[model samples]
Target chain A: MDVAIIKYNAGNIRSVDHALKRLGVSAEITDDPDRIKAAERVIFPGVGEAVSTMAYLRERELDKLIAGLTQPVLGICLGQQLMCQWSEEGDTSCIGIFDQPVKQFPAHELKVPHMGWNSLDRLSGELFPESLLGSYVYFVHSYYVPECEDSAAVCNYIVPFSAAMQKGNFYATQFHPEKSGGPGQEILSNFLKL
Target chain B: MLAKRIIPCLDIRNGMTVKGINFENVVDVGDPVELGAKYAQEGADELVYLDITATHEGRKLFADLVGRIAEHLNIPFTVGGGINHVSDAGILLSAGADKVSINSSAVRDPDLLDRIAGGFGNQFVVVAIDAQFKDEKWTVFVNGGRIPTDKELFSWAHEAQERGAGEILFTSMNHDGTKDGYACEALKTLSEKLSIPVIASGGAGKEDHFVEVFQEGKADAALAASIFHYNEIPIPELKSYLKQNHINIR
Candidate 1:
């Protein structure tokens, strides 16, 4: 199976590729639109600023290429945030795959980034199996998309938010499945089988 | 609910895992990547690798080891030691480390935190502080806790948070390697004062110590070296013990 991991200005893309390798899938990390479009599975993984990454995507027209992908596409961490309509980070506009807005976690008594392991609540969609309903996944982000109609899973910290969201062939996760340990590997395997 | 993280810290010297006795005596254990992979399978929430190598070649070897560890381990890990510049952090994170921790260098030039955090998001930077209690105060230490500075514990931690630190890893020189417990009172104060997460290190002996650090100390994460490296307290047993004690563990 041909799997292409879309490359951009974000960091830690190698970790995702390494995760797939552990599952016996060697994916090509590329920024070329043709390879991304021709692959059976495409993964958009990132860890960086929203505005600068969005600018890099637009500079190479990868934004439109990613939004129009008809095949099964999985976005991880910042990739998931960029899939939303807009983001509060630097007041940037993102690819409108999911009709949701991303906002920064309000400063309160709780920590801002919401880092570490958290259970995935209300699991739905193909990316998350029924067995993974209450499974723990790794998360490290200051901005989050609130739980909405398209939410595949919800995780509560400061408030209930979408741990994973899906619409059409586009699937996204706010957590890093590549770094969530065994359950994370299961999630990446599910995406491969999709 | 966010689960309390149990981190197994590995000290890397010349690409080999070693257990530091109060940052002085070093005992070679085994390969770091293999030990890390085993810890991950044993339910360790995360891993922290501190590079203690001094030579240039040793540093390069550590970076190579980091890449190998990333290839094998599935869980998130942080790398620290001798990180003086933002480019040093970039090298580690680009090599597949989830986070880069800054210690004495951050204290030397406080703005290093801001530059690294600016270059690679706030979540990428972790400020590690080592301090020892004396004269009714906890004074910060550098150069592997051999040199003491004028920076106080609480004030420096707050300043690090304000300067874009995502988390703070505090190691008590007094409690480290004692096998008694963590600095719970100080940890509680640090946790309450900062909005970012606090990782407690230095003193972890038994399962009860883990419980105390999380519940009483209010730390977001707990890190231990000798107990885990020497197999005195297995990761699985400790986690189950914490769970039985009514602590939220991962």
Candidate 2:
């Protein structure tokens, strides 16, 4: 399978590529629009600041290219955050794949970056299979998108939020499956089968 | 709520894990991929591999080992020791490392923290502080604990957090390899001072020590090498002990 991970100067791509390799799928990390457009499965994976990443994506016209992709497109971590309408991280606008805005997690006796393994429930998306319901997956994020019409899975931190969101052909996860061990591997496998 | 992490730090010397081992099937316990996979299967929340190798060839072997381990394990992995620049940090991150830790380099060029946190995001940059208590203060030590610095451990941890380091891996030189106990006093001070997570390294003699670090020391994570590597403690049993003691651990 020609799995292509959209690359535009972001972190954590290597880990994602390596995860795919473990599943026996060699994903090509590329910025070339043709390759990304022609890919059987597209993954938009990133971990970085919102404004700068969006600026780079805009500079390379990747924002529009990614939005226009018709295949099974998966967004991860920062990629999922940017897929929303806006992000409070840097007061930046992002690709409006979902009609939601990403906001920073509230500091109500909880740490800023909700960093560690957490359980997922209310799973109801192609991205999250039944087996993964109530299973633990690694999550590390400060900004989050609250539960909305597009939420496929939900988790609670300081507030109830979308752990995984899907709309039509586009799917996104607020957590990094690449770092989430066994259940994470299963999540990726399910996404691939979709 | 984020679960408290248990990290096993293994030192790499001569392109091999130098922790004395006695596994029959393991020809060389230093094999990075084998050990990493083993720890993950055993329920280690995370694993840290520190390269203490001196030879240049060993550096290449270390990178190759990281690549192999990244392919095998399905957990968060962190690498540190002798990383001097963002480019070097980039090398390990590109080799499938989730986060790259900087110690001596972070002390020399403090702004390197900003650069790394900028390039890799704060979540991907970890600043490792090796500190020793002396003269009524926990003093910062760099260059593998050979040279002492004027920076206080508390202030340095606060600085790392302000400079956007995702986490602080604090190794207490006074407690390291002693198996006495974690520097709880220092850990409590650090946890109270900094908002970022503090990973307490050194002085883990028993499973009860892990509980003390979390409940009393206020540590976000506890790290030990000797107890785990030498089979004095097993990851699963230790986690069960922590859970039994009412500590939230993955």
Whose TM-score is greatest here? 1
In Å, residue A164's CA in model 1 sits off its true spot by 0.3
DockQ metric for all predictions: 0.91, 0.66
Across A49-111, the per-residue lDDT of candidate 2 in tens digits comes to 899999999999999999999999999989999999999998999999999999998666566
Across all candidates, the chain A TM-score values are: 0.99, 0.98
The lDDT, on a scale of 0 to 1, for candidate 2 is: 0.86
Model 2 lDDT per residue over B115-191, tens place: 88877788888899999988899889998888998899888888889998989999898888788899998898888
lDDT of candidate 1 over B65-149, digit per residue (tens): 9999999999999999999998999999889999999999999999999899989888988999999999999999999999999
Instruction: Name model 1 segments beyond 4 Å from true.
Output: B23-25
Please give, for residues A77-171, the per-residue lDDT of candidate 1 as tens digits.
Answer: 99999999999999999999999999999988988889999999898998887899889999999999999999999999898999999999999
- Spell out the clash pairs found in candidate 2: B17-B30
Please identify model 2 stretches exceeding 4 Å from their true place. Answer: B20-28
